[model samples]
Target: MGVMNELINRQNVETLAQVLGEAAPGSSWGHVAGAAAELDGLSLRARTDRISTALLADIRLMPEPGFPTAARTFRTALGSAGFTGWIIWPVSETAVTLALETGAGPDPAGDFDDCLALLAELTPRLTGEFAIRRLLDRDLERSLRVIQGWTGHPDEHVRRLASEGTRPYLPWAVRVPGIVLAPEATIPLLDALYRDPSDYVRRSVANHLNDVARNAPALVVATAERWLAAPDGNTAPVVRHGLRTLIKNAHPGALLLLGFVPASLAVTGPRLDRKSVALPGELAFDFEISNTGAADARLAVDYVVHYMKANGTTSAKVFKIGALTLAAGETRSVTKRHAFRQMTTRVHHAGVHALELQINGIRHGHTEFQVQV
Candidate 1:
């Protein structure tokens, strides 16, 4: 089995049940074990859902009301699981999440404050990113206040949650409509974390900014420019990564900001090692660049391969080879080999393939080769 499948198997669930039973002597393990066994045939996500449902059924059996007491009870039970690192953390967090979800309902028997507090405690352990989404929808202003406070928290994880949880375009998480409609609302939080001491936090901040850049490119560019104006050794990575998508799209403003300008450049000797190839073959090529301009040229050298699809149409995929600076009359040579090995993600088709060189977003020379089954 794959690593993920092994991690969430029945054995892990039983281990969780055992830990919970140990944590709370009176807690019933038989029911938890029985429910977990039912998850044997389910897929990863389905198993998680089944486990949550099973835990909810068992929590209902406990005498304590849903809110603070029962939730706290579960959190306390997790303590006995020992610090097994991230492997088992999600399993524990899933149980806790079910408890919080059950307790925060309209007829919740638990205290709202207690649920929020438990979420805060769980933030560092397994990330309250998913749980916080519901809270944001319930009360945007209030959730923003809570998240803003977390930005200054001592834990780097909590601080990252503050930015990540509020991302307008957080992947696998529901969109925060308020942030989508008014991205400026997230800027204050981003500002607090743009130069965060933790690379972990700054990376999240960069992704958040990049998400914003999708709908508001100018805003992100302006923010990057401002940050770059007073370049800090730490913030440079964030800025560079945050602008990656834009740079790939060949945004004029982004290229200018990064100093990748167009120059009088020429590419020659675009040759493929094989004029025809089959599956499990390799395509190798070499090319040389000539800087015919008077001034020095900074070039972002890349290549694109136009792969033929089953429908006989073609799609161009770009790959970065290297970068260089060439003084007047300087010449440099680069070579690369790409594998035509079958991939689960891409199916290879037989047809004429086109190859080209791209410098500073401009395509220079072209060559063609053929591929067979």
Candidate 2:
């Protein structure tokens, strides 16, 4: 795949200029065209912001130059041969900038509501999730009240945006502290959207619930419990995904909700193939578990890697293994290989690292190994 910065490159900026210039013939789009060279060395999000800033200058040249005028100009360009793809990211952002910079009228509420409508209209092309943060931070209640209404919208993209845009910990999006402070504010939207007909919308609801779990574990559990109580065929997976973080942390409620109850099991060694591993290497391990109880047991088996951080502290991350039902008096062995390679998301430290097995919220068989990076 191409790097993220390529999403908003010189070609995209030039295309945006042509579309916007055609939509409003009188306005000069040279400001946007000039921003192409400035995108070099910048990250994806930075390029988006730079293009939006350039578009703002050109938007001011339009007649009555404001958010309403800019929204109409942009709407006019939405056709078969109009601007689309990543270029629309900056266009939507420019709309947000103009709305926030210049109020619609004396009534701020009117401007707020209208800006939201514009975003909803633009979201079908490219997400307005990131740009919606500015409004959420400005007045979360106002923005949410509008977004809540979006849950029932016919379009799946709008429905997904209703949940994704308001996530407390939305990735690559601006932080909305109000959502974190009041985690319950977005729960109703999740409640309305968790059973959406579209898988795309349902996934966003699951992610939104997961984001809420970061701050309010109890609240997330409660919400998930409600979902489970009145579940459809797809509800289980959604709850599992939504509660993944809590499950990794061994939250009792999350464990129980997923039916991974504590069980008596005779566990054997998580024997490592090698005690020491070199850089860009793999470590093979195997573990055996027998259900010692009178009844069968459901297992949520996972492997934990306590990675040594730069500060000499270890951070634990859980990697999932498949779940299975263990019959009474039956033993099963599982063998897996873990690769310790260089990755942008994870940095390997040359020191002692630890591995352990976790089943149904219970940890077992701690093992230490040396990593040479």
Candidate 3:
């Protein structure tokens, strides 16, 4: 990798950029030989040199817009350069970005430790399936140590990067590496970022927690329940997203939190709106339920909110208020609050959105209304 430094020098960027400028998108190949030569020149200087600086220089200096062509160039250059490990792993971002975008997949050029080392280098600059795959490739126990340490990086981008980059089944990103399939492995990482001060970061935290919700609802429910039972602003949404599917399944605890019981459950009307509320301000939804159960059952109703971004699609999240145990056969009146206030992270929108309330494990028999933003 040291031999490759020659190509990474300031002079190489100028040459590579000039080559790319002179050649049209599909015609950049003419420069590959020259660039590869420049890299090889550097490799000769060191016995350990596998990649030439020229190749790295070419990669870093590759033209941006011709995404596909540049991707091929990087892949070929990396293979030719004999990329051993992360000593050059800072280039993982460049390579992975191209590989991921080109749909070429990973080559795993180096040995096992190289994989972990690569993650340690690139996880901050690159994330999503890119990070997850590499992290999984590394020793699970050791990789986790790296991830745990990353949560505290002074740079919040890296911190937020830690969570968003690890989402299993992250679309437009790679899928989970086979080993850490279960959500348990991801818990500490999620827990650490749950209360991030940045809503941008928190939203990633919610999505990731929800990803966990898909696999281990029971555990996530406990996580959410823990936060619900206690009172913490930052953890509420995370807990809710983690518990959403469970709430829909009418988990006893989830139902209890959403407000459902034998008595006091009101003759509430359905939520009939298109499910969109505007953001940049605050949103509040108030509902009353009358419990009509004969025996004493806890009332817990959980709500799932689908938010429409300006882009014309929707993203979802879950929110929990509290749990109430209804008195046997008594008609208890319960009120639930849903807030979409500014500064709380999950913002609303001006497009079509939908909200669903799961009562006793089913969409309430009534219609749900769409609220104005």
Candidate 4:
């Protein structure tokens, strides 16, 4: 089974049912078991929703009246499941989502605080990011305060949440308007996690900074410069990954920071294996470069393909080929193959496409190819 399948399988729901049974013996495990049986016929998302719905009903059957009490009850039940660390994350995620969807009352702020605290203890398990995003929509300032405090938490998971939860362009989660509009607010939390002792937390911090870099390159460049000046072993990787987007975009400041100097290099013989190819085919090409300059040069070589769209327009997609250093009077040859496979996120249209080689962010050579259906 795939990872997603393994995560929300029949067995997981059964385990959850057992835990709930252990938590509140008076509750109906038969109902929970019946719900788990229905999951095998549904998709992953449907399974999650069904499980949450089933768990909520079971919790209601317990003595608890409010969501806060129910969330605590679920967490306590989860502890008895014999699953250590993050293996039980999905269960916690489902419990938290159930709390958020069905538990909010007149005191939303108070309810949100309770949920946030519960998430901290149970480990958000990848669900806290979106949950926090929703909370941000309800109360930006208050939610930010809660998230900011998480940055200093003793638990690395909570500290990671401080950055991950506030990412402006977090994938699969609703965007936080405040952070999207003014990302500078998140700088303090990013700074706190910049040199985090845990690699997991550092990765989240780096990704958060990368999201910030998309909107504010100058800010990221400045931050990278500062971090690099007094860098430790762990901090170095964070800065490098944080600047990945800018570096891939060939931002001048990013290249300079990474020691890749922009220099006029000679590119020759961009030879294609064939001038034309059909959809779902491969395009192979080779190119050579020479360092005509008098000094050693570090170069980032990338290729941009201007794909033809259905509307008779073209969209450019950049692909990184290779990065190398050439001594003065040295030459090198590189070859690459690009597959025009159909992608769900992209539609392929038959038309003449333009390919170009970029050296140190400068377009150096150009070629054309035809893609047919």
Q: Which 10 consecutive residues of model 4 have the lowest summed lDDT?
A: 81-90
Off by over 4 Å in 3: 1-132, 135-139, 177-180, 227-231, 257-263, 266-373
Candidate 1 Cα lDDT to native? 0.74
Candidate number that wins on TM-score, 1 or 4: 4
Tell me the lDDT of model 2 at 53. 86
| lDDT of each candidate versus the true structure | 0.74, 0.88, 0.52, 0.76
lDDT (tens digit, per residue) of candidate 3 on 6-115: 43443433344344444434444333345444443344223112223333345445455322444444334433323323323324443433333333333423333333
lDDT of 1 at 142: 64
Q: For candidate 2, what is the TM-score?
A: 0.96
Model 4 segments more than 4 A misplaced: 1-6, 29-31, 82-108, 124-127
The deviation in Å at residue 321 for candidate 1 is 2.8
TM-score of each: 0.83, 0.96, 0.48, 0.88
As a whole number from 0 to 100, the lDDT of residue 327 in candidate 1 is: 94
**RMSD to truth, every model:** 3.4, 1.5, 13.3, 2.9
Backbone clash tally (model 3)? 44
- The Cα error of candidate 1 at residue 123, in Å, is 3.9
Model 1 earns a TM-score of 0.83
- Which has the greatest lDDT? 2
